[model samples]
Target: MLDVLSEGFKEAKLKLKGKAVLNESNVKEAIDAIRKSLLEADVEYSVTKNFLQRVQEKALGQEVALRAGKGDSRVAVSPADHFVMICKEELEQLMGPVNAELNMAVNRPTTIMMVGLQGSGKTTSTGKLAKYLVNKDKKKPLLVAADIYRPAAVQQLKVLGERIGVPVFHKEGADPVTICKEALQKAFDLGCDVVLFDTAGRLTIDSALMQELADIQSATKPDNVLLVCDAMMGQDAVTTAKSFDERLSLSGVIMTKLDGDARGGAALSIKEVTGKPIKFLGMGEDLDRLEEFRPEGLASRILGLGDIVGLMQDFQKVAEEDQEAQALKLLQGQFSYIDFYKQIEMIQKMGSLKDLIAKMPMQDMIPKGANIDDRELTKVKAMIDSMTKRERIGQDNLDRPRMARIARGSGRPVKEVEELHKRFTAMRKMMGMLGKNMGGLLGKIPGMGTLGQMNNMRKAASQMGQMPGGLGGMGDMGSMFGDSASKPKPAFDREKQKKMRKAAKDARKRNRK
Candidate 1:
């Protein structure tokens, strides 16, 4: 998403090429360029100054050490390597640690008060966190509608609460502070373990809103004060974080709109100045779209490579505890529609369809203006729901009449039903091939273990699902394995697969050539 920042880093790294040492003269030019890049990315002016100063100090130190021939000048690391290391270390430190987990032990019925300016997705995040706690943490979290200024705001929270199966504590005409106080009492009485207070947000950091937030803080004495800043707001997000922290005594930050194509200077600068861990990230508008913030993965992503590690962790968390073994088995080609449906639900829990696509290594492989439709996921989900359990498990039982009946059940046309059948059949055939060649493919990608590992299975499932025709699509996993497999014909054949792989290999070879 931080395409601009990634490009700037690439440019800065290129400046050090052919340089033997990072002396003051050479390093000064490089540091100045980086400083300008940070400013252009909308990083706070003060943070940019101090950050560059640290990098410059490290760069100059490295140059001096190199001239002294410390140990081995023959094996001296490139200045670009050293430069990247310095930046990566400083950026990680600025962004705090790897991940931040929500606290549920802060005096039972832990109160989390959300504060931010309007359009920060404060309301949506509150519901997302409540859903996460209920589903992931197995805690009873009550969503309190304390933002009473906008009448529709309360209704919005209630609707989200209903959709996610969480209880909303609200009083339509009551004052926000009063509603919160009552909600806390209600939570205690109902034996709820967590309470999320959604406070009012203003257009900007105004005094009235600040004072109101302060009043809520004093009244609620919340265990965690989460400031929801929007990445699209840029440096203004930093300013908002600072202003909100001053009034609310924020415990952590939750940067929303992270899925946007902005440079993401806000997330980098917010944690730097606030000195508070970013507890959660709101990537989309869905109730289940919240992700725990991880600095290393985010930094890597801003550098333009996909965060494969982060994607694995996201899948790991969403996978059902009991379904782990089954999911692994399904990867070996015994996957039924029930197994497939569970995987789909896990994916839905992770985030938006667009978000998952953005994280694929093949994202750059796709041609421009290809009209890669994302709505197919919804269609797939609908078809799966339409099938009876017996039919889902034993697809051989489905004849033309049965297919039409299933299509009617799902409210989809018979053609759609046929499409699903074709895709599912393809998935079965492809998995058999993956079973044979997964070792080599898995080895090529670092951190992906054997095919049976949850990580590899999830990655393979996502990649396989995204190919053309999805499962029935010609480029599905069937094409991934060349001519070796015998008997049953898959959706794709040997020649098509050979062409795709040859094209991929040629592209890499051309880069070297």
Candidate 2:
């Protein structure tokens, strides 16, 4: 979502490379790049200017000893890395301290009044918030359809509530405030502790809308008033948020359509502008696609460092008890076709593969034009489904005749099945090698010899099934970042580079033939 900002930071980092320190000249250039990127992303002019000024002051004020190749070289942080880290820290500070919790009343049902302009996804966000509260917080939420002016707004809320298994309270021809007041009573009667008011929205803010919302607020005495903003609206979203907060005293914001081509300026600007935290990000249209906003995670993603914590959170959400065992087995090269199919299912549950990949660190390593086709996983699943249990578990049992039968059953070519088998075999071999060689690779690092031995012991225990499930014995991932910081960059190997180029040329020639 912050693709433009990410690219800009990457460019700025490159510009700082080989430079000694963050002096006025170099700092100006880097900040200019950032300024252009933010402006292009539709950030508010004042916010962008203030942010850049702070970044510049911080960068220029840092000790010269902190520069790359200065001070104690062993522990010296590179200027480029230092500058990027400053930017990352500033970005996080600008966005938030990670406050997404909804405020619930102690004695009564927590009335969460959802307010926004038309087409801002207020109704959909209401359903998503309900589902989140139900599944994550174990709250029984009653959805209120208070947007009586908009055609089918009530029906839409009902459909969303039905899909999410939340009860919808709507009374036709009722005033918005009256509907919300009645909805609160219904929540009390139905044992729903959370009441989500899906209030009406207009194409633009007006006195009539504001007065109606104010009336509803006065009657309901909501615990939390959240504005559902469209991230695509950019600066306008921030303006709308400020307007709403001024009137309704919004508790927080939910940014919808963040998965679209949003420049992400609103997400970065709204909290700073309105003095409200972003509670959730509406990543997609699905009722289950809402994500609690994590400022550190977003800042990491914006800096192209990826969000490992968010990725793990996503994994934890969909991971089954046996899935961890399966992952361990796959790492040990003992996984079968059945395990492969199950892994695919787990990934599908986690959401889009592209989105998942985007959360990986150093994602720029992926080929620029290459795309991950989710359909490919479905195709693989279809082929696996066509296979007998024996054939799935024992590849050696699948001779040409068996492969042909499976291909016919799967409605795919026999060659495609063969190719899949070949790739699977290669993957198993590579994973096996990686598992065995990981300790050695770690030991080769400057100060990780003890860690390498520990890793080996953990690996041994994992192989014997003595370790706990879900990477329990994999040790702390935080250590990896520490190791990376202390480790020396690898020297380029000319021979290896030449061989890679030659191999690529050969592959292209073979394809043409």
Candidate 3:
């Protein structure tokens, strides 16, 4: 994740806090933070300079305006919020307006030649791209093993092709250009809708490599020439893109290893430096993890508002229609350990838990750098497996004797088992309250009600199985092993709760004026 860039935006926002309007003095301090972040992220010198200049111009003297709310409820938003909006827009303008589509939309048997520096994850990206097209676009793809220089490159492509049920076209002892030339006919013969050429790459850009790539381009004339770059390369990735674009005339870029702690400068710099869009991002090693890059979504995440739309999209991808009905049942307080087990499986397919939280509007509430112990999911599963049939469904009383019996069977301590039961009971109680007045809870959160609002209530409700309290109170409704304990717990004694209710009632009565 781009933690560096996100941290910079957060610091900039903090610098502008309590200010009535943007001034040169305050704006300079905020922009200095951004400038330092961008440079530290390895963003190109010229691109960083130009981007900061644009942001400063837009933010200077900007005025806070009342949010577009109805009646007397409208309130003025802060100037820091206005500055973030400007930054998000400028960031989007810098990276995109991307056409995330491959050239195969109109062209039949579309040929896409993959090129990049060696060790840039080009071969792996080619395989992932094929799987993505097949899954997302219902494409019949032909993978051509044209990277003859690398050892086992052809075999690697063959393995990937076999795994995905896509055909691999390669000549056992031929040059890169000839292999690609023949694969074009193989695609036509096999009736493949697309052909991807996994071309040879070098340790560094060289005359020989460029000439080979140029030769393949002349012969095959691919509709899309994508350069797969490692996002961890930072500034070097931008340089690599420039060199390849000069020789091969690239159509797009696929950034790989974005799941790692890449500074994110390369992703921001490539488009500005070389005028190419990053069409796809390889987030993880999972074959299904290739994602279409969204500039506005990325920009919003950078500003720490989180992308609720993106979060729902991811939820929809891993959830089936029937699961929506099940989720509705769970949301209505008909939860069970069986349902919890299924959700754990669904979330495992969704990738890292921390990344999922980053897309949430309330991510800041969770302790930063909290080491989430995802292995706890497996431990929970083991504990559940040891439960009796009745206990697996729901336990009327999880007494110490039963917990000790289950802990012994699952090879876990009694304290661990008791903790798991406590979490489940807390969740069960919360869901019961939620099923009664989720709407009221939605309206109570300060800024989040607007930021995390959704048009599709069913879609949002369906995500309850994947996550709890999708609307608000995200810090308290945490992952199975998240560090939510680090957050301050509220005093919830009966008298305290009664006093809080009275305070809320009095505040509402005062609002009538």
Candidate 4:
């Protein structure tokens, strides 16, 4: 992702790194090359021009000095570093200081209007965002089917609503403007705190589509307007974003198909040109796969370590709710056999725990050839069900005799219960300590350096296996964490990996039809 920009900048940096002295001719040549790279990456023309101008200005201002070292003289503080730093700062400035999230009104009914080109995942993303709001934010949400032009669009919204158990407001053969008016009325009557309107899309921007969208905006006056754009479209994504912003005046963007092999130009360039935050990215078609956009975290993923920051953002959204927050607060201290069970359940809502950890730097820490114990979660849950609330919250309530009785009641062995108790106790202690140091130490861990005080407790799982006996149970833990690794990874479930393949096939079929 962002490979073109990454490769372009790397090449430009190399050009200036070897030179002994920087001159006007070589500097201009290098800056010119960088400028072309940005242009070719599908960056907006205006953004590219301003970006290159700043880099050139900074390069020209720096005084190149030759230092006599071991064998010959070399250009100290190579223009490459200067050039890279300027581009980084300007890119960051363009993207903004902090990534923005969906602005769901906390009051009564938060209304969001989605607009974009057809097949940009506007309808799919509308459902996904609604799920995020309902399941993660704990907000009562209702979906609005406002795309009246396409025959299947309303049914699509209805299907998604049923799948996620959210209500959809739509009337066949009704005009989009009228449907939006009725939808808002329904939201008010139902007391839905958030109403997500799935608007119409076109192959490209046209006056008619704009007029329809404008009419909906005039009628509904949605609290937020999100433009959904396909990341695989590359330069096309930029042009479409520009057109939509001019018409709808979007509040933010939702970039779809990032899980595909796209170069991710849309993810970077949209905010730079359109001046709107990328609120969310459709990593997969699954309701749980949508992730909040984080510029620095994405930059790290493109560089190397996976987007742990993105994973934290997902958890933060859910954990912010009162019930989930209270559960976490209770588990921070002593872990009982019962609390251990509750933790397993809470973790699942956050996404595949194994996949979440793999995206971060700790992928190598798991046991070699041993499939992640995604299934063991159920067993743990069963064990917790056997215990009383008091025993679940604190093992102190369970003595040797009590442990035996609890195991018998749960239909598990005494050793299994004891081992779970031990692991949970250790993990709770580790997490509590990590909580204190999250602002400084845990934040320093590569891509996670920025979360500052808001570091999510989910990150503490990586450190658990690093400690003694933490990984001993998993087979071949040594090779997984060893310097030399083995070959042949176990196959993952084919059905679970549906998003990318389906996205490609869908795009192809859509183009053909």
User: Clashing pairs in model 3?
Assistant: none
What residue pairs clash in candidate 4, if any at all? 338-392, 339-392
- Residue-pair clashes, model 3: 0
The worst-scoring run of ten residues by lDDT in candidate 1 lies at: 478-487
- Which digits, one per residue and each the tens of the lDDT, describe model 2 over residues 112-171? 999999999999899989999998989999999889888888899889988988899988
lDDT of each residue in 316-387, candidate 1, tens digit only: 767756765785665577778887777767777777555564465443343323333445556677887877
Q: What stretches of model 4 exceed 4 Å from their correct place? A: 12-37, 59-84, 97-108, 302-308, 314-513
> lDDT per model, in order?
0.74, 0.81, 0.81, 0.70
Give per-residue CA lDDT, model 3, range 88-184, as digits (tens): 9999999999679877646568889999999988888999999989888898999999988889999999999989999998898788889899888
Candidate 2: which pairs clash? Answer: none
Candidate 3 residues lying further than 4 Å off, grouped into runs, are: 66-73, 105-107, 395-397, 436-513
TM value for model 2: 0.81
Model 4 scores a C-alpha lDDT of 0.70
lDDT of 4 by residue, 360-473 (tens): 654334443345555567666766787777776663465778779867886777876675665565567655655455445545754433454234444444444333322223
Q: Give the least accurate 10-residue stretch of model 4, judged by summed lDDT.
A: 466-475
RMSD of each: 9.5, 9.5, 8.2, 15.9
